[model samples]
Target chain A: MLSQLVFGAELAYGTMLYYLVLFLVLVLLIKVFAWKPINKMLNERTQQIVSDIDSAKQKHQEADSLAKQRQDELNKSHDEASTIITNAKQAGQKQQEQIVSDAQSDAQTIKDNAHKSIEQERQDVLANTKNDVANLSIEIASKIIQKELKANDQKALIDSYIEGLGKQNESR
Target chain B: MNDKISTFFLGGLTFNIGNMVAATVAAAIVLVIVVWLSRNLQVRPTSKKQAVLESIIDFSNTTTRGSMSDSDAASFKLYGFVLFVLIFVSNQLGLMLQVDVNGVTYVKSPTADPMFTMTLALFTIALSHYAGVKKLGFGGYFKNTYLEPFVFWFPLALFEEFSNFLTLGLRLFGVIYAGEILLKLVGGLAFSNGIVTIIGLAPIELIWQAFSIFLGAIQAYVFVTLTSVYINGKISAE
Candidate 1:
């Protein structure tokens, strides 16, 4: 209940100037209050979104390259393992062939030696049999000559003794 | 109250006129709203208050940029923003508020004053002239704006300046003043102790008040849009 102050409705130059000045002040104040801060915030938001997209792209590319590196490493190890296995297999094959060839050569040498010893033993046995035959012949001839003293009478007695000795020797 | 105007005299050659309290109150209300909305503005702008302020600033920027040259967009936006708030708030002052202190009734739009609207129009023209001068040099601006398109058209161009002032100020004053008077008459009907008050006045007042809001916004937009157009005319050689 304090409305005793009455304002005249006349158009005053001072009042017009007052309003213009007021408008000028209001314009300046609005720039401070809403315009500057709002624009700044909007610019910040735009920059933030752009930077976020940038960082996300960077991270995605990094992940892609890392995955490729991992795949490459896996492939390399896989190839290395297969190569090592192949090399080991080839070495094992060579060792096995060498061992088998050496054993075959040793077996062949032993077989040849046994064959030469058998041939020598057979030749020696034949030579000894011929000598034994010659010795027997000489002993028979000497016995006949020594017994033939009287031609007719001694001939029948020597023949009978020689035949009896031959019979005894054959039985023994 | 034959005329509901309160006049205050200071000391010498200056005096306050045409609802100083109402104008001050309108300005203060806008100031408070602007400050309150500006508080805690965020990059994301979650609050409706912040959203409202952001939209206003954005609209002003876009409108200024669209209507005027790229050079004047920044400075004119400040002028446009302030004018919009002053006119819009003052235009909508009498819708739902009644500030009755003692005997005097303080109701009506501050923009209903011809002096106030004319003052803004004068500023718009002055700023545009200054912009033209700054762009083309004083001699070039004078020649281009007044002396071009034949030598006799200089008087016509001078008359055009007066007309710009007249049209811009009068249009705003006419629309807002009529709206305020209509609201006053309708408001009187509602308070009158009669069956007609209940049956006729209240409903019509409600509908008219609702429509007034839209009218007030349109008037404010028109004022700013015309200001931009006038400024563009003065600055551009065409």
Candidate 2:
């Protein structure tokens, strides 16, 4: 019974063992070779996504700084224009008072002269304020852009500015 | 039914009824899985079902692409999935069904048989040769194979061929055959003793059987994973 049992078991095993080895070898070979390339592509794609995100972030920072500079320039020009308008108003008031005190010229003529000169001064201030704003805005913009010229850094600033413009356009 | 399931000879090797039925069942199960997964696949992969399927495919795809070139790896993705399902199902059959024919019990896992593994290995090896030949002409393929060693050992070329066949067939056969035999031996020993026999008939047998089923599933996965590795090695340079 023992001999028969052993023989039967061996026969069953011998028949199957050959196939198992073959299958293992084939599987091992394919896994090592064919599968590697697919994995490589996945890794490459992941890296590309990361790089894209980094570039986008840099662009945001650059735009943020450019916007800050533009705001400061606008505020400076507004202050200067207000100072000029206040000084002109004070000079016009003084001339009107002097003509009234002298009593040589008609009161209506003095008032008309004061009004005409004030109007002229207002026109001059408008022209100068327009020119000042233009000049000041250009200088601020250039300074903001030139602050950092590293490839990635510069790209960020430009991207930030474009995004700001885009937002403004969307609002309008 | 007999006519439809006729046995065919391949190089004098006999393929019996069990082999035919098992292979058919394995193929059918695989096809079902593919169709089911195909119908449910989503563009964004949000649902749990879609995510589960995509993850397996994605993991395998990433591994394969890393090993081979892009175009070549893309072509081989589905084959890897098919391999996983087929081997798992085939091994599970042994635990699920045990047949007794003429007082001799046959607990056959398709993978436990050397014939099936050998056939699969031979198929892959032949495919590699075909790929090599296609990439490099027939003359080049033979030249590369034989010319690997110092130019004088031409007679050893046949031995090299035989060794490849032997190693591929034996490795899987040894592992699975040993495992199945070990399980049978343990079960047989338990059955022969009165004390063991009493316990075997109780809930322990069911628990043992279930555990065996799990083992079968795991072994099958291992077998298929190894097969893919071998196939990849043969077809690509790296």
The models' CA-based lDDT, in order, is 0.76, 0.58
Tens-digit lDDT string for candidate 2 (B73-173)? 65556555556555666667666665655533343566665566566556646655665676557676666665555566566965866666666655655
For this target, which candidate reaches the highest lDDT against the unseen true structure? 1
For DockQ, the strongest prediction is 1
**Model 2 stretches astray by more than 4 angstroms:** A1-172, B1-13, B62-66, B99-108, B136-140, B153-158, B192-238
Candidate 1 positional error at B216, Å: 0.6
User: What lDDT tens digits, residue by residue, belong to model 1 across residues B114-163?
Assistant: 77778878887888788889877898888888998988999999998889
DockQ, structure candidate 2: 0.05
DockQ of each: 0.38, 0.05
Model 1 - which docking category? acceptable
- What is model 1's C-alpha RMSD? 6.8
Instruction: Give the distance in Å from residue B178's predicted Cα in candidate 2 to where it truly belongs.
Output: 3.2
TM-score, one value per model: 0.78, 0.54
A74-107, model 1: which lDDT tens digit per residue? 9999999999999999999999998898888888
